[model samples]
Target: MTPAARLSAAIEVLADLEVRRRPVNDALRDWGQTHRFAGSKDRAALASIVYDALRRRASSIFLLGADSPRAVVLGMLRLGRGLEADDIARLFSGERFAPDALTDDERARLEAPIPDMPAASAGDFPEWLTESLERTFGDDLIAEMQALADRAPVDIRANTLKTTREALVSALAHLSPEPTSHAEAGLRFHAGDDGRGPALQVEPEFIQGLYEIQDEGSQLAALLSLAAPGEQVVDLCAGAGGKTLALAAQMDNRGQIFATDIDARRLAAIHERLSRSGVRNVQVRVPRGRFDPVRNPQVADPLADIAGTVDLVLVDAPCTGVGTWRRNPDAKWRLRPGALVERLADQATVLDRAAALVKPGGRIAYVTCSLLPEENDDAVSGFLERHADFESVAPSNVVEAAGLPHLAEFATPGGGLLLSPRRTDTDGFYVAILRNRAA
Candidate 1:
């Protein structure tokens, strides 16, 4: 496909995104299914263009004095992608599905946007989210948000118990573009020719459970939890067992791992991952909502069995995934303050209930992907204050021990780590280990 046609595809998908409530990824998938002839490169190019347009959606439209996908794409080509007007004219030329010829005003704006980008616009987020972004990121919001606007690399963590970094690297040779390990077991593969299949699904090693396709930042999340071999641990709120697998591998399949979640579907998904992972220690625990009384035996009530019994608990609590905008950009536009507040209510409830399962002196690694303090720092402080027995620990010590540098600088005053996308070249994650005091 010509560059122009690819741009045309982006315009179509973006228009669909604007009109329909469906996510960008969903729209792109539906679009691709309709056009099966599009090759991997063509699909990737079109997808990239559409996402780039979304990232700069506000600024691009504002600059071009238009909000349509065509106008946005035109502004993007000139501004974000550094295309000349002639280049856009060539791409959007009448020969292809590209937009009609750029209007004189668009051409002029293409030459120069109002300014580099106003404070709110540079973040490439909705104006309403600006206060939250600014509050969460402070002076660094622009830098981090800009990074998010770019493509997130394909991150994979080699299950050290099953495969070494070198071994997996050899296995991924056919995937082309050899992967470079960010941390000992973390691999980042450059996006390249893959026939448009889910990258890891095709690899035999992945099928055999040699590695798990998880973000490097996610790998760090599990690592920070410090699940040692032979230690009894409970992965409270383990959705789909992404970190549970990592914790299992860390335990060398030796300790008791109580993996629990409120959602049965998420727990059900972990079976395939666990079986493939060869992790024998994991015991799947399904929960009845906190309101469910113990008299009813029909619902799963595993959290009741282990209250104050485990040495460690990993609370991978749910939150607004503001930290993962690189992968799920459309969600930012969908979220409202009311919805976020409601989610926090759910989080606080989960935390209070989960805290009961952590034994005296046991550590609970509180976690969230959100950059907002409401979901992170505030949550930790509230939990610690409400439960006098619990004391917070600085995550920098754990992170630095994991070989991550410069994070010690962001350690919270009371305790915890606020990882902004700017300081950490990874997702926005807040992890704090709190230990319960003895009576």
Candidate 2:
């Protein structure tokens, strides 16, 4: 498809996304399925323009003075996409199927002055994210916002137990992006040839499960859990088992790890992943212990089975998912101030409950994809202060222990680790690793 057609497609997808509150991926998928004639390049270009628009929605509107998809496409071409004014005009020219004739007023706005915008505008984030963004960002708000504006890299964690980084690199060699090996067992790579995404999915490496598509930020959260071989670990809120798989890799497939969630279907999906990845240690507990192929008891509360008995428990809790703004920029518009408050309350409840399963000297690590301090630090503090047994520790210590830089730290009432994406290059994940006092 022509550039114009792709932009037009993005506009249609964005419109649907706004109305249904569906994610960009879903909208794009539905649209793509409907338009089978569209090739790989067309989809890639369309997704890029759409996400770029979403990333800078506030500023795009401010710059172009028009909020239509065409205006957004024009604004991105001028400002975010870095296209020159003439180029933008050309892209929207009548010769193309993209947009209708660009008016003089639209041209003027594209060339208008750009100055210091408000925090939301500068950060390219929602106004609702103002206070939380300030707290998490502190003085370097602009730099962080700029970082978020770019398309996200595709980072993968090598299943260190089965594969080495070098081996994984060789398997993914046809793909050009180099993978950077992190301190823990993470291999970070970006899709420079964005158009070649399909080749990666069909590769034997992905088929073999030698590497899994996880963000570097998420790998940090998994490492933050600090699971060891033969230690009983529970990923209490193992949504799709990203961290659960990470935890299993850490345990060296020697200990019992329970992959759990309120959703049965999600847990069910882990089996194929486990089988492909050659992981044998995890027992999936869906709907309160329904996996009979495993030894876990249906009568067991699961938490009670390990209450004060687990060497490690991880609560990669659900939140506003603010940190994942890069992948799902539309979420920013959907988020309301009230949702932040509700998320904090939810985090507190999950933290306290997850902590209960930690054995004396065992640790329960709390984590969120949110960049908000209310979700990151405040949740840890509220729980630590109320629970006399748990204490705080420096996050730098954990990162250093895991061979990472000391971006930030906090001591628990009793000791724990807190980390955010602004300090870490990964996702906007906040992790606190706390040890339960030994009896």
Candidate 3:
């Protein structure tokens, strides 16, 4: 397919997303199934255009003075791809399968100088998040949000149980991998100009479980827990067990990790991952029934016996996932106000469960892949108010315990650490460690 045709396809996908309010992947998949003639390259190109448009959706709308799929795609050509007017005009020539010829108004708008935009529009994020983001980033809100609007690099953590970081990096040399700035076991790969990263999953090293595709921020969050060898740990929300596998490597397969999630379906992939990575210390605990602490506390739960005895509990709670916008640009637009409120409630419940599981002097690492203060600082504050036995651990101390003193710079005012695209060159993640003070 020609570039113009690919752009036309992207516009259709975006329109589908706007009307159906479905995930970008779902919309793209349905489009591909219907247009079976589109080659792999064509589908990938269409996906890139659609994602880029979403990433710059607000800015594109501002530039073109319209929110239609065609206008947004055209504006992305100028704002995202940095195409000249002539270059865009060539693509929108009204030829067969190409977008209709650009109207005089569109041409004029494209050629006009950019106007001053509000932070929400300039940052390409929803207007509702402006105040929350401002509170979190203050002076650096636009820069931080702009960084999120950009593409993310692919990151993988070397499975220390099977290979060293240096060995893994050498094996993947063809991909031009680099050691991550903060995570000692992480390697980073830049995406191509087409916005696609190396197919690491197909690499022999990846197949052999030499590395796991994890964000640098996620690797650091797992490290912050400091799950030492021979310590009993509970991965309270160990969905897919990414962090659970990391914790297994940290413990050298010596201590037991009770890895479980409320939804058994989410934990299905973990067994295969654990086997591939040679992780033996993790015990997979699938919930047998609904997990409502108030109604059915620890009912049919595997970790019931270990209550008030765990050395560490990692609560990787669900949230708006704002930090992952660089990779999931569509989610930033799909997010709604009600979703944030639901996440806050879920976070509180998980934190309370973690408090019950932790032994005296044991740590509870509260983690969220969210930039919202409501899910980060506010949630932690609320947790502490409810659980008097738990005290907030200083970010400096948490990083020091993890042997990552450099991360002290990203410490939040509320004693947690915040990692962002602009600050840490990583996805947005908030981690706070609270210790049980009761004897």
How do all the candidates rank in terms of TM-score, highest first? 3, 1, 2
- Taking the candidates one at a time, how many backbone clashes does each contain? 0, 12, 0
Note the Cα lDDT for every prediction shown.
0.77, 0.73, 0.92
Cα displacement (angstroms), candidate 2, residue 219, comes to 1.2
Leading candidate by TM-score? 3
Instruction: Give the per-residue lDDT digits (tens) of candidate 1, residues 1-439.
Output: 7787788888888888878967888999999999999987888888878877777777777778777878888877766878787777777676756557767777777776357677667777777777767766778788888877665667788887788888877778766534543356877765643213346776788889888888777777787877888988988788889999999987888989999876666787898999998899999877654332333447666778778778888889889888888777778777788878886877777777667888877888888888777888788888877888888766667766667655677676547776655666677777888888766
Judged by whole-model lDDT over C-alpha atoms, candidate 3 comes out at 0.92
Ranking by lDDT: 3, 1, 2
TM-score of 2: 0.90
Per-residue lDDT for 75-149 in model 3, tens only?
A: 889988998888999999999999999899999988888788899989999999999999999988998999999
Q: Estimate each model's TM-score.
A: 0.91, 0.90, 0.98
Determine which window of 10 residues in candidate 2 has minimal summed lDDT: 410-419
Off by over 4 Å in 2: 193-198, 288-300, 405-422
